[model samples]
Target: MRVLAFLDGTLADPDAAHIRVDDLGLMRGDGVFETILVTDGRPRELGPHLDRLARSAKMLDLPEPDRAAWERAVRAVLDNWSGGAELALKLVLTRGIDGDPEQRPTGFALGMEIGAAVLRGRAEGVAAITLDRGIDPGLAERAPWLLLGAKSLSYGINMAAIREAVRRGADDVVFTASDGSVLEGPTSTVILLRGRTILTPPEHIGILPGTTQAGVFRGAEKAGFATKVEPLRVDDLLTGDGLFLASSVRKLTRVRSLDGTALPAATEAHAELSAAYEAEYA
Candidate 1:
């Protein structure tokens, strides 16, 4: 696959890379970024994705990205990509190298086009184990200086949780607070179905406020499902009709099991919700 990297103001092949290590993002993981799926050479929800990226950057105290420049770079990468179907574009803006490690560094934008391999397409929806620390409701309302819902480069803990789930023979991990209130997945958003209502955790619960998940809910409401963002518990899944993990790439994958227990088969509501979500991006 041919890949292009836009570093600072120059766009070139990654192998011709001259990325500097002094950049905090290169050495210390100090930056914010966004990944988007591209279909038929057009980005899905381009405006919304850029909005989220800007919000995350502001939360991190980083300079806002140039939205127009980013879009042009994305289009350029796609133009060079021979395989245009179901591709992915990543917009990564990092704090550039500082003259001194103790000083704050200016930021630079990087764009890359890569192929996506979606395991969820062929595999059954994932089952997950709950985390002990449920996300605090208060944190979602007020941004903490460091954890203000920013898509920071520091995601070691999140990745570790997902690895733990894989070790237990599950596809992913679902985090909940000690109180048993569901939070979200390692890299995807959680959505549950109960009868006619579609449930997602409120953003005020410190959830990532997933882009794809929100899109799915919007499509669901249009398709006649009563969608809501509310607190959900692990017990809800054990007793609910079905559950799903939503993401830009994964789109929607039904959860067939939870904590080793098999979820009830998909109902009419689940089918309708899934169809609505899939059809929107299809």
Candidate 2:
């Protein structure tokens, strides 16, 4: 069952929740959103998710999100949640009707089930194909209009890449930039394990800052694992001791293969990593 609530704190039926047709979020895909993982009725890294939501809004020139109102909306949904081990809590803020800046932005929180396919990926892992993202990574600094680093609602390309991956007989996608740097998975952050070090591309390379990945790095550090943020090349993805994709909803899923090539399974290290992930953080 899905539960939804508005910024004003009214709980509603998710299936029936509606927004005005002229809302720019619907008209032009103009808005920002954050998907948070709810485990055992608790939101993981909620502060980070909200922080990112605000950052995205700033990038899109939307009104600053009212944090307390969103928090109240989230609480209402969780209070109404049906018992479950996992949920996807999405908080959305839109450029409201007619795209008027003077109007209150449209906002809501939705709590829903995490799909079985997604859970299966976390357990059995995924097979992915590499796709060229078709942009110079460095260009993002010069092409601010592209909104490459913001988690805005303009995700047609990301979804299309995943569809292309499936057509190529893969379960997911890893996008490479014009410079041939392995950027990230369409919906998740890529992390590589080498010895005791866990590495990921820095956010400065024109990707959204990953909240769940930051959480994992903290966990890894406390468990004696080192962490670094560096650009990853496609070759590096193939040579890592272990490859993982992290997201709020998926938590951490191993990448069993890439472009039809099997990667090393750092079993013991991965187990320890999983253990650390389960320990979670405050």
Report the number of the highest-TM-score candidate: 2
lDDT agreement with native, every candidate: 0.72, 0.89
Per-prediction backbone clash count:
4, 0
In model 2, the runs with Cα more than 4 Å from the true position are 99-101
For 1-282, candidate 2 gives per-residue lDDT tens digits of 789899888988777739988998899998999999988778998998999999999989888899999999999999889858789999999888884657778999999889998999988889999999998778779888888889999899999999998999989999899888988889999999999999999887789899989888988998999999998999999988999999998888999999999988777887888778878843
What local lDDT does model 2 show for residue 272?
87
Q: Kindly list the per-residue Cα lDDT of model 1 for residues 1-282, writing each as its tens digit.
A: 554645334457666655676777878777877778777766777788888888887877777777777777676676666764666667776777756655444433333444233554324556777766545667666657746366778788888887887898887777886678888887788888888787988876676778988888888988888888888889987888788888777777777777899887675555677688767777
Checking candidate 2 for backbone clashes, the offending pairs are none
How does model 1 fare in lDDT?
0.72
Determine which window of 10 residues in candidate 1 has minimal summed lDDT.
108-117
